[model samples]
Target: MLASFDIGALGHSFWALTISGLTYGSIYALVAVGYTLVYGVLRLINFAHSEIFMLGMFGQYAALMMFGFAPQGDAYDMGVAQTLMYLGLAMIGGMVVSGAAAVGLERVAYRPLRRRGAPALVFLITAIGASFVLQEFVHFVLPKLTNNTLGGLNAQQPIRLVSPSTQFTIFGATVTNVDIAIVVSALALAFATDRFINGTKFGRGIRSVAQDPVTATLMGVSRERVIMLTFLIGGVLAGAAALLYTLRVPNGIIYNGGFILGIKAFCAAVLGGIGNLRGALLGGLLLGVMEMYGQTVFGNEWRDVVAFVVLVLVLMFRPTGILGESLGRARA
Candidate 1:
């Protein structure tokens, strides 16, 4: 039961849940955009995106371990410069590693089947199988291969990279230290992505390839390269999501926790309309607000149920989702 429903704790918990849901939904949107991006061009859901996210988390953990995650109490006096440097390295390492793994998954798993003209249903099966394989990969193979079981995974004091004890209030919502970090970080990423897709030459190449691969190739666009970069960007986004999510929850054991979020995120993407970035963001933000508001009205225990309930209702009314574009077409 959420203390929010009780008058004594109402404001704090309500606002906490509200901001928490927004942060989660934003992270989910990042993962969902991956699914939508791949689906946009290939018309296939890259269910392995969850694995990409999982690996991203693990990748950062690995780097953190290498750099020595700060000790508990006297982690004091850690310079902002050092902290930022470590965070930057972890993020870059996570993104690059995850992006590489994503591409590898594409080339190794799907590309051959696609070449053989595998049916969409078969591809669906492959996606599921890929997911399970990835789960197993993280659970057993990665440990065995590296000969190092990740310690302190569920430790009480999970690492916090950038913690500014600055709180703010807005629209009856209380924002916390991590809340600001998550929101600002996500906004920055989103803004940069907008600029990249709208301003850069490579972005146009991606758009061209996405709209029509054959036509793009005829017009001197490298379909292969664009597809590769699409996955790269997808992986990068998943990595970004990993940092935000890891900081929020802080104590997940298995790497594939991204699976749950990925499912919800993919749902969000479809709810808004797959292949539409703006739609993905809109659906994610709306879904977040709905989830938090639902928790506020009911109890936090019903958050997931509430979210899906709203989604079901929305789908019942607009079966093609809010933006009304089905499958590959970008929705308005």
Candidate 2:
């Protein structure tokens, strides 16, 4: 194992891997926010959140189709302005679909349970079941609904809006336009979310509910409204991330595509402190960088192993996570 370790490879590709890692980390951070927000408010893991991400992929694809951009073997040659307009439209479609689905999920699957005072275990099981149901619906039912024009066992033929071309070079790493777009867009969204959470009346309500729901309700905060808002915000972010992810990996929009990525996002939430927003971002970047480096040094097969190993170590030594701050108690 020592002989097989390729420290030199890591050394040579350090900057390239870092850029790649940060790009992926941005996506992970966005998805992880969904997990953290739900956990902070409801104390539920929301195992189905990943499926939300998956649905967002299809949502964006559908949006592109609506704009007369059909799935094809190669990217269309739409000029810069037209491409941006369609991309923005697709993102909006994704956000709307994902946000609606998340709200509906809460209404259909969770609200009744909440009313019945279901146990945490029951919620967990339901979340897992919901995950499978969503996956199979796309796998089996979506094709039927669309007359096999979309959603089946195979990945959607990619509708590449942006072909990654080298835009700049930094420290021997070539950065592509897609990389820049993904990172910058993710950061802007994250910053906006942070500001909204820490600087708005509804944010205060969310925090109050997370800290003490019974007291917050007594104080005139509508707990149900806060919960719905949390789900909506998280889902919208996931939808944005889904579009960015497709930009990076054009062929990644499959019915079950979000499973592994969703698990990684969940791990990111746990690694950064399950309820802490900033922690989720930090953990995702770190995890992405570490995974890239590990893949370089220990071979591609060890990439996932590194993420899990890091999670296990964190749990063993610092279960509270890196930041160790809960969302409710976090100061502005």
Candidate 3:
């Protein structure tokens, strides 16, 4: 047990928790970058992002359930190539499903009200309410589709992905197949997003519209398309993050787990400066590293306090966040 406080304990804690913090921070930064992107262009919090993450988890789980229910449920049926194919399919499917859900929510729930000239307050509440509605909708639909009273499948079952006897040592740490998969997948996403945003017409449009909606409109940039695409891309990223999170936790997906992580990502966005893409990455990494060590030193009970403390300090020193962009600033 940790004795309230000990100055001499700090050094030991720092050494032990350094690696832990970096790993956790990388994930945090990746997720926060999603929030920064959506908010940078739209200026709306997208309160439902956490729920979108939750949706991704459910979607992936549903896909996995379907696979398990098939006759080839046994791992034996999958050769090396086939296993890779299934993973790719599952992740892509989950992301697509989540992106579609976000798009649908924006169109059906948020767009109509915005079109009617609703107050920002009304918009904010609507966003929050929309999150609840989505959560309820998922809960309502899952049981009907799966017919498994206890959340469709047994998530507690030990996950045996690559092989039973597959483990490697890296820097005195055991690296499992799952870890390799997560690192590779996250890197792939990072690379893809970099290319898509900087090398594509759609990305050009997104930036143009973000800079000046009226001018972008005059230049033939469709605000609607940009907004829609933003939501879609954000949804996809959140979906991918959800998959990574589950692999890390391994205890199965909880319906509301997204809220906390969502908030953390949002904080990360704010830390890096909301509109700055690279800043989100940096802030998330810093936050994750700080949080890891804080928990190690102070125990799990103060993890949140540590996160908030970092936020407060960052805000105090750099109110515009690490990227020097203010998330709360008015756009349009």
Q: Is candidate 1 or candidate 3 better by TM-score?
A: 1
- RMSD (Cα, Å) for all candidates, in order, is 3.4, 1.2, 4.0
Candidate 3 or 2, higher lDDT: 2
Per-residue lDDT tens digits for candidate 2, residues 170-197, read 9989999999999999989988988888
Candidate 1 lDDT over residue span 127-225, tens digit each: 889888988777667766766455222333356665545488776767777777776787678667756765789878777767777888999998777
Q: What is model 1's C-alpha RMSD?
A: 3.4
Q: In candidate 2, which residue pairs get closer than 3 Å at backbone N, Cα or C atoms, i.e. clash? A: none
Candidate 1: clashing pairs of residues: none
TM agreement with the true structure for every prediction: 0.87, 0.98, 0.85
Q: What is the lDDT of candidate 3?
A: 0.70
Off by over 4 Å in 2: 1-3, 330-332
Total clashes for model 1: 0
Model 2 reaches what TM-score against the true structure?
0.98
Worst 10 residues of 1 by lDDT: 148-157
